[model samples]
Target: MLLWRFVGRTNVILSNGVNWQRHSRVVKSALNRNVPIEKFASLTKRLFSVMGDGGRLLTFSTTLTEASRFILCLLSGTTALGHDFNTIVDNHSPFVAKYNEVMDSIASPLFLVFPKLETWFPRKHVIRKIDDLVNDFGKLLEDKKQRPGNDMLTYMLEEPEMTDEEFRDNMVVFFIAGHDTTAGAMSSFVYYLSKHPEAQVRARKEVVAALGKDEPNIENLRHMPFLQACIRESLRINTPIVSCLSLMVILSPILRAIIPDLCSNGKSYHIPAKASVIMNICAIHYNETYWPNPYKFDPTRFMNQGDGEEARIDASLWLPFALGPRQCPARNFAMYELRTLASMLLQQWEWNLPADSPHHDSIKNGFSPFALSLPKDMDIIFRRVEQ
Candidate 1:
């Protein structure tokens, strides 16, 4: 719930790019250029190799191809837990199975109408699944700590980390934030790029140029300015998370009487003092006053070297990971995932729109209040690039 709360810190986000430098300093080991990029490149190459001639239908990659929501979840784990456990999550995690079910059963609207349902009364099925994930991973970490392995879990364990309770709490927070947020962002990236083939081509060119007959290295990905811009643009336009919801006020129950009713609205009359209220996040991204041609899909808007009024107008456009002290802690890790996957995908695969793919304007990327946008059920054809 805290992860999803609004901080109204849009203007201050990039303000602390210096602080971003500081905090990002700690996770540099995890984001170590060699391990993450190499693992991701290997994963992407292998996933594509599954699409070889005669098109032998593969299971895991097909699952990834379809359940990208889950793929993003695993990718989050890939970053958080490192490459060691990603395959375990891909093949073995029951939570992965159950999460997809919860998503399939509950569409976004019901939550929008009743955000309280998320806090007070989550679906029993979802709750069980979540509990299962937390408990299972918690135990796994504990076990690994005893074994003292070289992976991230052991690193956290032996490194004089938090108490057991704190570890468990952090895991709960970590898993949810790490998984849900990345899934949300990647879905948007895939969906938007799918819609805009020109941008996709540009991304492909950037990646191929960077990966020229060699594995993607951190240096190459860092230098791919156009691809990074595309990811940033995708994130800007299709901010997977819209806004954090909050009850109008946080008055204690004992002193609640004098509070104005916020929930009275849609009650056919006055709203109650303490009803749940959603912050309008997409409004910030799409604001016409701030953004020129707000409705137009353009990533170049972020990089435009406009002078006079235009550059001033372009300053504040997007933050899908969110803003403020409450902004995502795993942002560095997320960049690793987005850039690495993008680099490898572009380097190895050639994507073409599936037949009958809808136009960008016609496609309706689903939005679940907090989830800014969702990837529609779109099939992308991928063939290995000929050397």
Candidate 2:
């Protein structure tokens, strides 16, 4: 595989089948650690404090993006490194900058196939920076080996089967995925609800009823069904991972030379075995056959419980996190974070898009293959609600 030359084949991002099992186990085990409600509360307070007094407008596009970056960075550091947010921030790390630059450069099709060309392009500096970042992570892992801490890094290091290269690659993968993707989801949640005032009102009411003047906790979050529905709706509408690559197959020359077969398993048809198929998440989500009035932002689609909803849902049809064993390991974490952040936002403040903001108009146009495409200009205002 092309990625093997850059990042070792043992890395979870490139590994497959049996090879991926051990790495998956380590990641799931580490993430399973109880994340205290205090962490969400702390970040919520920081975000709420930044909004300021009435009429002082804020740009959701930039502001929430920054907030998500900080929150995710802090969470990743603490969860993976066992480092405090203050300690991590105080270190003035270059990881975030390098990560942003590398991700942006990788989004281009040129880099997807010929990543080495990144060495010659305008993003040449970023390619080098990413290598440095990966090396730095490797060194961090080495140091942890000498005196391991009780964190995700140490947990993986403790695993006898995990290699140094695999550890470093997994660290980078988790760092990038844990932050940017979750940020995109959170940003979308805020953006979508801002446009759907009725949904916002219902969500806020659900949140307030669940926790009256109390900080958001996992226990309380579970009971707020409407808020959860809104979250699912946001995820369905603006899936963070818009597309993903499927397996590769080799075929005989005769098979390849022919027009190819319309492969089907008594259900939907698939591409020929020789051709690679990119799972189009947006297309699946908008399939009106499964999702009635698909374009409309309606949370009710996921709400009917006793109506045999679980039995009826086609797992293949809705894949915001992708499907199968390779699906997102941190999905539960992402959902909890979105739920907590949205609950806090709605409970404490009344927010809406600026009258002249063009975000709503440009939302559909933002189609990014890397993650959920953000609105062109996300501008909204928040007014603190009286207790």
Candidate 3:
């Protein structure tokens, strides 16, 4: 009920069967077509301009969160809706504010604990705001119909069976997924890099060697193996989403009879006809069996050993983007964004945690109303690198 209130039931993330196929096909194609590297580069440059040069102590958690939101809002808006939110310049954009409000309301601990209270004592104001946001999406769809462009909405309109509600719901899902989660991941990257100067130095060296005074492109990003390892390690140590949404599966009677048990970690349990299973991402990522000294921030685990040997870790163990066909459709896009931004930061500045900062020992988790795990009050001292 809470999720439906936010993204509705028809978005690609939660939808099933033919509906899922249709939504996934269009979303994946749109994301594949639009890489947005130039957009990310330009926006990041603007962000640097806003931050200014020189040795400055900046609060990274706030800065990165806002920058990520602005960049992603523009990216998702332009690609999916053929609109520019202009949130980077105008921080108080009405649409963005309303969207944030809706997300916060959905993440309210009170409502989450007692979901029935929402039904019994309805928050009419929040409901009205949600409806208003949907109506705003409806307006965007109408505008696209009159003035079609090379965007996802234009492509989705080609589907005869698609509904307006489905389109709006998917847009909300894209906004939530592309904005906050990526922001949290970026925060984790900075937190890890700040705490470990060795990893940061190695990553910067690779970035500089690959593309000195040049903008990062897809080919250049591919060559930064150490930087890639840093990203993977950061993701493993602090997965953005601690736990995925519950996945409910209905088992057939015949199948249940044939396979009456499910096994995990040398333990077996009888299966019921229907069960809601939630994947605890944090537990798997930190499991001692899979990762040695799991709490340690070591990027070498992902690095290739000497003599062209590949890392022997199982691919399934890494579930930051999840696994299987239902994996995030925008995985490539998100990775490119991360790599590009990280490269830009490395090229322009050398940053470390402030002497008086609280995160000297460990990265503190921020309070997020949503599923994302964020770094709290991260203040990094950045020195501009001489060209």
Which residue pairs does candidate 3 place in steric collision? none
TM-score of candidate 2 against the unseen true structure: 0.81
Q: 51-161 in candidate 3: lDDT tens per residue?
A: 675555443434445656676676667655777787767878888888888877777788887889989999888888888887887788788889988776787777665
Off by over 4 Å in 1: 1-35, 53-65, 82-93, 102-130, 148-152, 158-161, 245-278, 304-316, 358-360, 366-372
Ranking by lDDT: 3, 2, 1
Off by over 4 Å in 3: 53-63, 148-151, 158-161, 252-265, 307-313
Q: Measure candidate 3: CA RMSD.
A: 3.0
113-145 per-residue lDDT for model 1 (tens digits)? 777877787666655644555566667567656
Give the C-alpha lDDT of model 1: 0.55
Residue 45, model 3: lDDT of 79
The global Cα lDDT (0 to 1) of model 3 is: 0.78
Model 2 agreement with the true structure over 1-387: per-residue lDDT tens digits? 123333456766668777788888877777676554567677567655655544454433335555566676776665666554442233244666665556665566667667666555546455576577668677767777887775677777766787777888787777766676776777778878888989999888888998998988878887787788787888888877788756565554544444344222234343465676567889889988789999888887777766513233577887887888888887776777777878888887777777777675535425354545554446567666666
Q: 1 or 3, which is superior by lDDT?
A: 3
Predicted structure with the largest lDDT when compared to the true one:
3
TM-score of each: 0.69, 0.81, 0.90
lDDT of 2: 0.69
